[model samples]
Target chain A: MEQILANGLYLGAQYALIALGLTLIFSLMNVLNFAHGQMYVFGGFVTYTVVAQWGLPFVLGLIASAIILAVMGALIEVFLFRPVIRKSKRDESTMLLAAGIAFFLDAVILLLFGEKQRGVPKIVNGVFNWDMRIIMPYDRILILALAIAMIAGFIALMQYTKAGRAMRALAQDRVAAQLMGVDVDRYSMIGFALGAMLAGLVGGLLVTITGINLGMGGPTSIKAFMMIMIGGAGVISGAIAGGFILGMMESVGLTLLAAYGDITYLVIFASLMVFLAFRPQGLMGKPWG
Target chain B: MTKTYAVLAAFLLTIFVLVPVTISATGRWDLYYTLTSVALLSIGAAGVWLTFYIGRINIGQGAYALMGGYVSAVLMTQAGFSFWATLPLAGIFCAAISVLIGLPILRLRGVYFAMITLVLTEVTRLTALALSITNGAKGITSIPLPGELSIFGLTLIPDFSTMDSPKPAFYLLAVTLMVLTYLVLWRIVNSRLGHLCRSLQQNEELSASIGVNTAYLRVLAYAISSFFGGLAGAVFVAISQSIYPSSFAVTDSVNFMLYCFVGGLGYVGGPILGTFLLYFGWDLLSAAKEYQLLIYSSAMIALMLVLPNGVLSLFDRKGRRK
Candidate 1:
C-alpha cells in the first residue's frame, strides 16, 4: 500500500510537470500544442546525448536540455505556428499545424537517432529507506523533489514576474491587452518557451525513470491531454490536481486490476466521457465565454 | 443543372467503366489494388467530411471503421453470415455505437473535444487487443472472401474465392460503393438537414437560440458520419479478407482528417479528390526510402501553409473568376 502511494505520488509529479506546460500554452494562446510531447521526447534525447555521450554531469544535462528546448519551442512558435495563425482566420488549423510539426519532428528524430530506446543513468546511485519495509530510491525522491521545486518555481514566476503578468493579461483579453501595450506575439513566444522548458525538464527527469524512445511522444501527448481534461482545461491548478488524480487512479487501478493489463487507458477514457457529460467545463476550468 | 449533372454522371460512369477495363487488359494488378484502396479510403473520408460540415473535427472516425471491420469480420467468421449481409448491419452497429459515445463528447468545444476524440482509436485498438472475440492482437485471420449473391439457388455473382483474380471484382465493388457514398453525401449537402448542419458550423449558439435543436442535428450528422465510416470499413475488410486493430490506427484517423482538409472542406467532393492525391502522392514518394515520411510530412506542412483552403480551392478560385 505504501509502495503504491509512493509510486502514485511519483507518477503524479511527473504528470503535473508535463501538464503545467500544456495548460500554460492553452491558456495563453487558446491553442493546444500537439507537438508538445515531441518536444518532451527531444528533451530526453538531449539529456541522453549530454550525460551519456558527452560525459556531462546529470544536473548540467537537465539544465542544458531545458534551455535548448525553450529556444527550439520559441522558434517553432514563430516559424511554424505564427505564419499559420496569421494566414487562417480561425484557430481550427492550429491542431493540424501542430500535428504537422509533430510529424516533422518524429521524422527528423527517426532519421537522426534511429528507433533504439536510450536511457540516462541515474544521477545518484543509492536507495533511501524508511525503517525496514518502506524503501525509496534516491533518484525517485530527487524526481519528486525537483518536480515540486520546478512547479513551485513556475507558479512563483507566473504570479510575480512582469512577463508573467503580461501573459495573464493577454490570456484574459487579447485585444485589450494589446491596447495596453502588451506585445501578443512576444508573450505567445514566452508562453511556448516556458511550456517547452517545463516539458523538457520533465522529459529529462523521466529519462532516468522510464527511458526515452521516439514512440513515447504520441502516448505522452495523449496522457497530457487527458490530464488537462480531468483537471480542467486551461486551469493550471486544475491540471496539477488532475495529474495527481490520474496518477493515483492508475496506480490503484493497476494494483487492483492487475489481471486486466492496459485497462487504465480504457478507464481514463470512460471516466473522461462521464466527466464531460456532466461537467464539460471541468472541475477547475472556467466555462468557455 | 440537371443537364450538367447528367453529363457529369455519364463522364464518371465512362471513366470508371473504361479505366478498370484498360488496367485489366494491360494486366496491371498493382494499379488495380491501388485504385481499389483509394476508393475505399475516399468512402471513409466522406464520412469524416460530414462531421467536419457540422463543425466537429472527428479524429476518431477510424475507430468506427475499425468497429465496422470487426463487426463484419466477427459476424462472417463466427456466425457464417455472408459479407453482403453484414455490410449494412456493420454500418448500423457502428452508427448506434457512435450515438452512444457522441452524446457526451459533443458537448466539449473546440480542442477539448478534438483532444478527447484523439485517443479514441487508441482506446478501441487497446480494447481489440484485450478482448477475446477480437482474438487479442493476433486478430481474426483467414476471413473468407465475401460469399456469392444468389436468388433461390440462381447465382447472381460468383464468390470472390472462385474468381481467378479478385482484384478486378474488388475494384468494381469499391468504385460502386464510392459512387454510392458520394451520391448520398451530395444529396445530404443539398438537403434541409444539411442546411441545418451548416448553420451549426457558422454560429451554433445562435442556431440553438433560434430553435434549431442543435444537439439532435449534431447527433444525427455524427450517426450518419459513423455509418459511412462503418460501410467503408466493412468494404475494406471484404477486400483485405482480414481485420486487424492496427489496420485502422490513429494515424489512419489523422490521415482521414487530412484527406478532407487537403481536398477542401468547403465542398462535398473535396475528400474524393484529396484521398486520391494524398494516396497516390504517398506512393509516389516511396522511392525516397527512409526519407519518405520526412518528405511526406514536410509536404503536408508546406501544403497546409501554401493552400489553406485545400487543393480544390485553386479550382474554386478559377471557377469564381470565370
Candidate 2:
C-alpha cells in the first residue's frame, strides 16, 4: 500500500505537468488543444537532442527546451486558435483544428524521430535507499521535487502576478479584458507560450523516466485530456486534483493488473467514461456561472 | 457523407467490377484485396457516421464494431453457434455496451467526450487483447463460415461465400448494406427525432427549454449507432474470417470522426462521402504511407481553414436554397 501511494504520487506529478497545459487552454479558449501530446513529445525530443545528441549540460538542455516550446505554443495559437476564436467557430472548430495540428505534429515527429523510441539519460543518477530497505531512484525524487516546485510556482504566479490577473480577465471575457486595457490577445499568447513551456518541462522530465516516440503522443494527450476533464478544465485546482487522481488510479491499477500480465486500458477508459457521465465539467471544474 | 458515400460506392463498384475482370483479362493483378478492404472499411465508417449525425463524435464506434466481430467469431468458432445466432448476439452486445458507456460518455463535451470515448475504444481493444476468450492478443483466427442452410433442400448460403472475392462482395456489400444504411438514414433525417438532434446541436439550452430529454435522445442516437457498428462488425468478421485488436484502435475512432466531418456533419451522406474521400486518398497516397497522416492533416487544415461547413455544403446550393 505504501509502495502504491508513493508510486501513484510520482505518476500523478507527471500527469499534473501534462494536465496543467490542457487545463489552462480549456479555461482560456474553450478549446481543447489535441496537439498537446505532441508539444510534450517535442519537449522530450528537444531535451534528448541537447543532452543525448549534442552532449550539452542537462540543466541548459531542459531550460532551452522549455523556452523553445513556449515560442512554438505562441505560433500554434496564432495559426490555429486565433482564427477559430475570432470567427466564433466555438468548440467544433477547436476539435477539428486541434486534431489537424496533432496529426501534422504526429507526422512531423515520425519524420524527425523515426519510429524507434528514444530515452534521455537521467539528469541525476543513483538511488536513495535506506540501507536497501526503502529503495527509490534519485532521478525520480528529483522529478517529484521539480513537480512540487513547479506547481507551487504556478500557484504563486496565478495568485500574485499582474500577468495572472490579466490571464483571468481574458479567461472571463476577451471583450471585457480588452476594454479594461488588459491586452487580451497578447495575454492569451503568453498563456499559450507558458502552457507549452510547462508541457516541455514535463516532457523533459518524462524522457528521463521513460522513452518517448510519436506514437505515444496521441495516447498521452488523451490521458492528459482525461485528467484535465476530471480536474475541471477552467480551474487550476481541478487540474491538480484530476492529475493526482488519474496518476494514483493508473499506478494502482497497473500494479494490481500485473498479476494478469497487463492492465486493461479499457478499464481505465471505462472509469473515465463513468467520470464523464457523472461530472461533465469534471470533478473539480467550476460550475457554469 | 453523401459525397463520401457516393464516391466510395462508385469507387468500390468500379474496383469490384473492374479489378477481377481486368485480372482475368490481363493476368498480372496483385491487389485482389483492395475492393474487399475498401468495402469492409466503408461499412465500418458508415457505422461511424451514425454516431456523428446525432451530434456526438463517438471514437469508440470502432471498438463496438470490433466487439461485434470478436463476439461473432468467438460464438461461431468456440461456442459452435451458427452465424445467424452469433450475428444478432454481436449486435445486442454492442448495443448493450454502448448504452452502458453512453450513460456516462454522453455527459462530456468537446475534447473530453472525444478523449473519453477514444480511451474506451483502446480499452475495448485491450480487453480483447487480455481476454482468454479472445485468444489473448494472438487474436481469434480461422473462423468458419456457414456452409449452407437448407430448409426444404434449398441452399441459402452463397455457393462459395461471395465474400471471398473483392468484386461480388463489393456489389453485395455496397448494394445491400449501403442501401440499407441510406434508407435508414433517410428515414431518420426526414423524421421528427432527427430534427430534435439537430435542434439540440444548434442550441442545447433552447432544446432543453422546449422539454426534450436531450440526454435520452443522445443515448438513443448512440445506441442506434452502436447497433449498426455491431452489424458492420459482423459482416467484417464474415469477410475477414478473423478478428484482431489492430483492426480497431483509438485511431480508428478519430479517423471515423474526421471522415464524418469531411462528409458533412448531421447529413445523411456525410459519413459515406467522408469515408469515400478518406479511403480514395488512402488508396491513392500509398507511397511510404507514413506520410499519409501528414497529408491527411494538411488536407484537414486546408478544409477547416477554407470551409468550416464542409465540402458537401459546397455543392448543396439546393439544400441551402431550401
Candidate 3:
C-alpha cells in the first residue's frame, strides 16, 4: 500500500505535468492537443542529446530543450491548429489534428532514434529507504517534486501574474476576454507554449526515472488522457486529482490482478469506459454535451 | 441494367480474368499478396470509417482485429477447427464482443469517445498478452488447415499436402470476403439507414429532433463496423495462419484511422484506396526505420496543412463538380 501510494504520487506527478499542459491547451483553445505525447517523447530524446551526447550541463539541457519545444509548439499552433481553430471544427476534429501531430512526431523520433530505449542521466542518484524493498530513487522524488512545483507555479501564475489572469479570462471566454482588451490569441499562444514546455520538462524528468523510448507516446498518452478525460479537459487541479486516481488504480489494480492471472488491462479500460459513459463531464469541467 | 453488369464484369475480370493472366505471365506470385493484404486491411479500415461517419473514432479496432485473430488462431491451432469453420465463427464472435463494448462507449462524444476506444484497445492487447489462453505472447502458430471442409461432399482443397505459402488463401480472401464487404457497405451507404447516419454526422441534435433514434443508429453503426472488423481479422488469420498480440497493436489501429481520414472518411472506396496506398507506402518505407517516423510525421503535418479534406476528398470534390 505504501509503495502503491508512493508510485501513485511519483507517477502522478508525471501525469499532472503532462495533464497540466494538456488542460492548458484544452481550456484556452478548446483543443485536446492529442500529439502532446509525441512532444513528451521528443523532449526525452532532445534532453538526451544535449546532456549526454553534447556534454552539456543537465539544467541547461532542460532549459534549452524546453525553450526549443515551446517555440515549436507556438509554430505548430500558428501553421497547423490555427486554421482548424478558426473553422469551428468541434472537439472531435481538433483531437484528430492532435493525433496526426503526435503520429508525425513519433515518426520523426522513430526515424532519428532508431526505435530503441535510451536512459537519461539521473538527476539524483540516491534512494529513499522506507522499507526493505521500499527504497525509492532520488530522481523519482525529484520528478515528483518538480511536478508539484510546476503545478504550484502554474497556480501562482494563473492567480498572481498579469498573464496568468489573462489566461484565466481567455479560458472562460476567449471572445469576452478579447472584448475586455486581452490579447486572446497571444494568451492562447502563451498557453500552448507553456503547455509544450511543461510536457518537455516532464519528458526530461521522466527519462531520469523510467528510461525513455519511442514506444512511450501511445500508452503513456492514454494514461495521461484518461486523467484529463476523467478530470475534465480544462481543469488544472482536476488533472492532478485524476492523475492520482489513475496511478493508484493502475498500481493497485496491477498488483491485485497479478494474483488473478491476467485481464488487468481489460479491467482498467472497462472501468475507464464506464467512467466516460456515466460521468462524461467528469468532476471539474462543465457538461459539454 | 447494363451499368450494373459492367461493374460486375470489371470486378470479375479483375478477379478471374486479369489476375490469372498476370500470374501466368509474371510467375512471380506478387499479385496474390497485394490482392489479399488489401482485402483484409480494407475490412478493418471501413470498420473505422463507420465510427468516423458517426463523428467518433475507434482506435480500439485493433483490439477487435487482434482479438478475433487471436481467438481464431488459438482455436485453429489448439482445438483443430478447420480454417473454414473459424471464419464465420470468428467474425460473429468479434462482432458480438464489439457490440458489447459499443453499448457504453457510443454514449461519448468526440475525443472522449476516441480516448475510451483507444484505451479499450490497450486493455485488450494487455489482457491478451497476459492470458494463458493466448500462450502469454508466445503466440499460437502452426494452425490447422481448411483442407477438408466440403460443400456437398466436394472438398475445397485441391492440394492438401503442401502448406508452404499463403498465396492461394490470399486469392480466396480477395474473391470471397473483400468483394462481399464492398458490396454490403456500398449498399448500406445508399440505404435509408445510411442517410440517417449521415444526418447524425451533420448534426446529432438535428437528427434527434427529426425522430431519428440517434443512440440506436450509432449503436447499429458500431455493430456493423465491428462485424466488418471481425471479417477482416478472420481473413488475416487465414493468410497468416497464426496470431500474436503485437500484430494488432494500437499503432495498427491508428494506421487504419489515418487511412480512413487520408482516403476520405465517408466513402467505401476511401478505405480501399487509402489502406493500400498508406499501408503499402509504410511497408516500403519500413526499410529505413530511423527515418520512418520522421517521414510519417512530416507527411501527416503536410496533409493537415495542405489537404485537410484528405487525399480521397480531392477526387470526391472533382466528381461532385461533374
Q: Name the best candidate (by lDDT).
A: 1
Question: What TM-score does candidate 3 get on C-alpha atoms?
Answer: 0.91
TM-score of chain A of each: 0.96, 0.93, 0.93
Q: Tell me what TM-score chain A of model 2 achieves.
A: 0.93
Identify the CAPRI category of the predicted complex in candidate 1. medium
**Positional deviation of A228 in candidate 1, in angstroms?**
0.9
Better of 1 and 3 by DockQ: 1
TM-score order of candidates, best first? 1, 3, 2
For each of the candidates, what fraction of the native contacts does it recover?
0.57, 0.62, 0.57
lDDT of 2 at A189: 88
Backbone clashes in model 1, listed as residue pairs: none
Backbone clashes in model 1 = 0
Q: Estimate candidate 1's RMSD in Å.
A: 1.8
Interface Cα RMSD, each model: 1.4, 2.7, 2.6
For every candidate in turn, the CA RMSD to the true structure comes to: 1.8, 3.5, 3.0
Candidate 3 regions off by >4 Å? A84-97, A111-114, A130-134, A173-184, A261-264, B1-12, B155-166, B286-289, B319-322
Cα TM-score per model: 0.96, 0.90, 0.91
lDDT, residue A99, candidate 1? 81
